[model samples]
Target: MMGSRGTSAVLSRAARMRQKLQSSLEASALDIEDVSYQHAGHAAVKDNANETHFNIKVISPKFEGQSLVKRHRMVYDLLTDELNSGLHAISIVAKTPTESGS
Candidate 1:
């Protein structure tokens, strides 16, 4: 029973978190997709009805010289507020211009 207050709250929270990351990092490229709807009714979702999963693709010079784990950590730190609050899992794909062949 994913009521209005259940999923929407997390979705809104996620959107705001993404917005903050985008603005703060001024990322060269950033993509945030709301895949929560797709996970609904799925086995893994299990009626969590919260911001439990995400696939983030970020390309920024800020990531230069940073290892994959460090880059992801940077992104996580930016959204620490949300992650600590309720955001569960985040799948990050961070890259720099050189690494991305850009």
Candidate 2:
């Protein structure tokens, strides 16, 4: 399925993030909102920057016993490549299924 791998290369950053988080976390629910436009004029943002900011909400069993900081760290760790690749900021709401009442 090398072609599928190639297809992923063309996905929007948000789509790639969604795929990564959903698969890695085994998330029951996942939402990824691109908020980059809100940072358009911020000093760190270049005129051509896209997918630099995001709001992410995820509910997963993997988070059940984890502390908030640990959950966030898990997410950050999963996205290290994205962070290194110009993804600047993320607002994350990491939750367990019970915590989210899902």
Candidate 3:
């Protein structure tokens, strides 16, 4: 583990981000995967093995009419705090229900 507190803090932040996105986006489906292990030795990562990167997939009707840039921005905006606090990167896959092949 990432010095215990570091891992817990990172996980807590990610959980909070998930909660916020779930509530704010009203997503039908949402998945947030901690991808820090994939970047364990990168310079941007200062927290040893902490959760510094994430891959997020969300499906919501809210995304139905949004541009891709706009949809990405919406997620980034919601995660401003995490970004400020050592969340080095994010990959977002936002889709409407229909766009998700549902």
Candidate 4:
């Protein structure tokens, strides 16, 4: 008998990033925008690449005591796999909940 579990669902890059950040950072707010279209003609981006560029904004307690560089590093570390897998660039706006008036 075949099992009911057919093909597993694949998560989009933005969705995957959101899940990772939300779970790891306990973010009060999170936004991920795919900006690949803006870089369509850029030399580094291939013509067929879809989720190559992103703009991320996140506010979390995890960033409370971290410096700006540290916060950016934390975000980069979390998305290392994504970065390695054709995610070419990201503009991150990471902030503490307090800093964001949350």
**Whose TM-score is greatest here?**
2
Please give, for residues 67-100, the per-residue lDDT of candidate 1 as tens digits. 8889888989898887776566677889987788
Query: Which lDDT values do the candidates have, in the order given?
Result: 0.75, 0.93, 0.88, 0.91
Model 4 per-residue lDDT tens digits across residues 1-102: 445343213678998899889999999999999999998878998866899999999999999889999999999999999999899999999999889988
lDDT of 4: 0.91
Considering summed lDDT, which 10 consecutive residues are worst modelled in model 4?
Answer: 1-10
Deviating ranges (above 4 Å) for candidate 2: none
lDDT of 2 by residue, 1-102 (tens): 568778988889998898889999999999999999888878887776989999999999999899999999999999998999999999999999999888
lDDT-superior candidate, 3 or 4? 4
Which structure is stronger by TM-score: 1 or 3? Answer: 3
Preferred candidate (lDDT higher): 2 or 4: 2
TM-score to native of every candidate shown: 0.71, 0.94, 0.85, 0.90
Q: Pick out the ten consecutive residues of candidate 1 with the lowest summed lDDT.
A: 38-47
Q: Going through the candidates in order, what is the number of backbone clashes in each?
A: 0, 0, 0, 0
- Cα lDDT of candidate 3 equals 0.88
Candidate 4, superposed: residue stretches over 4 Å from native: 1-9
lDDT of 3 by residue, 1-102 (tens): 479456545457678888879999999999999988999989978859587899999998889889999999999999998899788999999999999987
TM-score ranking, best first:
2, 4, 3, 1
Candidate 2, residue 1: Cα displacement in angstroms equals 9.3
lDDT of 1: 0.75
